[model samples]
Target: MAYLADTYIRFPIKVRNASGVRIWDLDGKEYIDTFMGIGVLLFGHNHPNVIRAMKEKMERYVHLSNFFLDEDAEYVARRLISETGKGGKVFFTNSGAESIECALKVIEKFRKRNRRKGKIVSFVKNFHGRTLGALRITGFERIRIPFIEHDTEVVFLPYNASEVEVFMKAETVDAVFLEVIHGSGGLNMIPGEVVEVIKFYQKKHNFLLVADEVQSGLGRTGKFYGYQHFDLDPDIVTIAKGIGGGLPLGACLMLGELADIFETGEHGSTFAPNPVALAAGRVILQMITAELLEHVTNIGKAFKEIFSQFGTVRGLGLMRGVELEKRVTKEEFLSEGLLVNIVGEKTIRFLLPLNVSNDELDEIAERFSRVLKV
Candidate 1:
């Protein structure tokens, strides 16, 4: 602990092991994990299928440069494109932030190629990522203040505000980065009115819409992509978190005309298409079937019924946030043998696995109810 950097507000418990939806600490105390590795473990920690795929790929070979052709990479990319139901190319990355950076680059290149200079529209309280390019558009002022010289011109509109209508009509926007369900900034779902405005303006203005599905995509929100919940169709989409099946894999999917925005030397990544991660990702994509999505929906409904007694519940499917009437702490939840994410002091964000069972949900509900009663 002394040697490690204090970057993360480290969890008190040192995890000994995890399986399904439960974690065991160093002292052998079992706890229900609602955070699900910040929504990265779609199938829970060390899912058998994900593990088998990775092991099988490792047996064959592991690291191969992007210059070489790999079947797994091609398959994963094709599957991702197919899931979007939109014809597009894919750029692989190592994490959500890298995927976001890739999306930004696509926006820049697209604007340049078309000889159009315009501002990028992003919503306030939207959590994109932490990198410089991502932070530039990210709505958090505290984090963005340190890196103020972002250089790119971006308009930060209030999330789900009617003010967006004015900006859309007045501004020549190159692209708009949106989150169908906001993750780190509290699980706020983007409303229908805003989605309609963006869709309407996109038709009239011809600007690109980039959906940031890092936290809410790949069955996390009971859909293949979060934007599917809305009527909007994004031209560019950045994905991460559960897409790796608990490993580090991300992608920036280009759709419509923006698919060919990048040429040969324009963009690349060294470890983006790692065989092991892609192998796991391929299984993840296969496992998020219609049945699993329905399970997620039912679980979300159960969660809402339990949590609504505490306070307002926001978000859809397994992606949920409970804004309690009383302020709570992560330490309090930890004390109750429950692991959950606390955003600020009042909101508890729950990113449970898509495969979590009804019994597991009841256990979580009981644990959470106990915590609130305290």
Candidate 2:
């Protein structure tokens, strides 16, 4: 009966409106949104500042091609680079997948230019994106590999810190992909020492370290960048999800010599760096102050303490994954008016908005307790 593709696992609830951490369905039922639009709504739905930015930009212009120099986009890019404390270049895109696509081209091209092999190393159970190029680097083979193929040679390695030293020393890798906090893949963490080891070898072997911050960036990890938690500094970082404040936007941050590899007209996007989206993104980035990050860290600790009563909780900042002895199903949360994703066999992921109130989180936890009891 429907004309559109049935790509998503369709839910029956039709949301009429949402504000903050609450979503109201057509039937007038209220739900506490713990998933936070899959970690896209960093400040929650219809945030005042985000809306203000969009309104101001919309009054001027909404769309702008890559040909023109958009001021808002430039403003946001400056902040992004400054946050990293590294003077680098950035390429804007409409989504995380597109950013990865750009990174793939830039890194691969850099390797080829240097007379290096076209080999990429990423961790097992780590997710990058669903596009053809990103899928090749993604460790989950069962989802998209059958429909697509890649020419780039990719090797999936374990997330062990000790083994990374062995593997990196042995392989002739061109680029190494990392997601410091695994977002979609059960919320696994890249150990602190693993990053140290990679940093140690990256200098010795002379390889590019691409941090996939699509889901874990933008204060979601209690830091401006998820890679900041570790001692390692990535050469290329792809960011999205929360940057646009619910509108589609993403960027690839390049540092050191890797910054100027993408020549003019080499790689670009048609819908990237839109004036409206850029305005929203700029405001969101400004809103993420050190105080807010510290607040997120505190909230994560409080939530973890409460979550431990139910099961094992692991992850950084607000992007924690609770692994229950008796896993909490998505259906269970739905019935109890809570929105969360059952990431795996016994894992429920929590992607709370950065500015979510402690009261809201307490209520969600209370609801979670009741759901588990039943």
Candidate 3:
């Protein structure tokens, strides 16, 4: 018996060890891991290259404050900035929520500098994060109520292009934060036309366009970033989950003139740029090149074909959700030894790693078919 928080009473799976698309429970029962640490293990549990890099860095150092710049930190940041293709700068943090905080702070600072109390327009059912400021901007109210008093001046809008002009014309609208493909908010895919409208509004109003790619970045969505699904360039993009393999690391990439909004002391974290985590992030990114990305995409297509037999598959690349029938619940599948998660009551979210093999994908699909039959 484990002494755990009541929060976990709803879904209890005591893991003893995990590696490569599979995890073993405390009772030695091995199961395929479709959740992938909530989309953190892009290369799967204990990837060799990531492990080697982290071990090497551990031998050198572990926790160094942001006061001194580490080589790995600089390396990862440079690579990320170069890939963003927007002349952007990067600020690292320890978690996705912190990265959201950094992004919000940058937008707010930009507003303050421009002497505009602009409002931030967010889409309905978009999940940014759960921190105070991030929670304020998040479209979900169940998580926002605790900090309602401290919420920012954010306006909720439908995830469609037709409503863009009206919202942008509203007074004091400063930035637009969105997830090209909503992940936690039910794997909802934003229409390409909606993205085009956002670009138009950003050009017309001069307000910042922010893409919250925390759950959709680092090749999770068949592209380097989810925004790539649409022909658009955001002023700022936040990322986390798969960046550091399995380690905790988050980054906020700022583009155009918005990159200079944060001064030296405007934002930071004690473990933000830990060399070990940065090394892991760099190696994981290298492992997810064109070939691996294609592999993931192909496997995703296969999985979708199998999952389509059950219900609609909603999402791109490995960040997909199988919307099951009302009679089929996510918890039912999990209890049957498949490590899938619920996006909602009727949807089983599958965040496959970029390096997952085709054979493993087939096995998972077969198991899922069996479970769904039950």
Q: For candidate 2, report its TM-score.
A: 0.96
Q: Please give the distance, in angstroms, between residue 31's alpha carbon in candidate 1 and its true position after superposition.
A: 1.2
Give the C-alpha miss distance for residue 103 in model 1, angstroms.
0.7
What does candidate 3 score on TM? 0.94
Query: For model 3, which pairs clash?
Result: 118-172, 119-172, 119-173
Candidate 1: list runs displaced more than 4 Å.
149-152
Off by over 4 Å in 2: 148-152
Task: Give the range where candidate 1 is weakest over 10 consecutive residues by summed lDDT.
Answer: 143-152
Tens digit of per-residue lDDT, candidate 3, span 1-374: 36776544354668898889988989988888888888898888988888999999899888879778887777777777777776878899888888888888888788778898878888888888887778878888777776675445788888767686666666657888888777887887988778777887778788888888888888887778888878777888888888887788999988888878777776778778778889998887777688877876787788778778888899988899888776565466676578777766777788888877778887887788888773
Task: Report lDDT (Cα) of residue 234, candidate 3.
Answer: 84
> What ranking emerges by lDDT with the best candidate at the front?
1, 2, 3
* lDDT of predicted model 1: 0.88
Which window of 10 residues has the lowest lDDT sum in candidate 2? 143-152
Residue-level lDDT tens digits of model 2 in 1-374: 29888778855689999999999999899998888889999999999999998999999888868779988878899988888888799999889999999898987788779988746898888888888888878878786568565545788888888788887777787889999878778888987778788888788888899999898888998998888888668888998888988889999998878888878788878889878889999899889999999999999999888888888899988989998887566777889899877776888889999987788888998899899982
What are the TM-scores, per candidate, against the unseen true structure?
A: 0.97, 0.96, 0.94
In Å, residue 132's CA in model 3 sits off its true spot by 0.5
Off by over 4 Å in 3: 1-5, 149-152
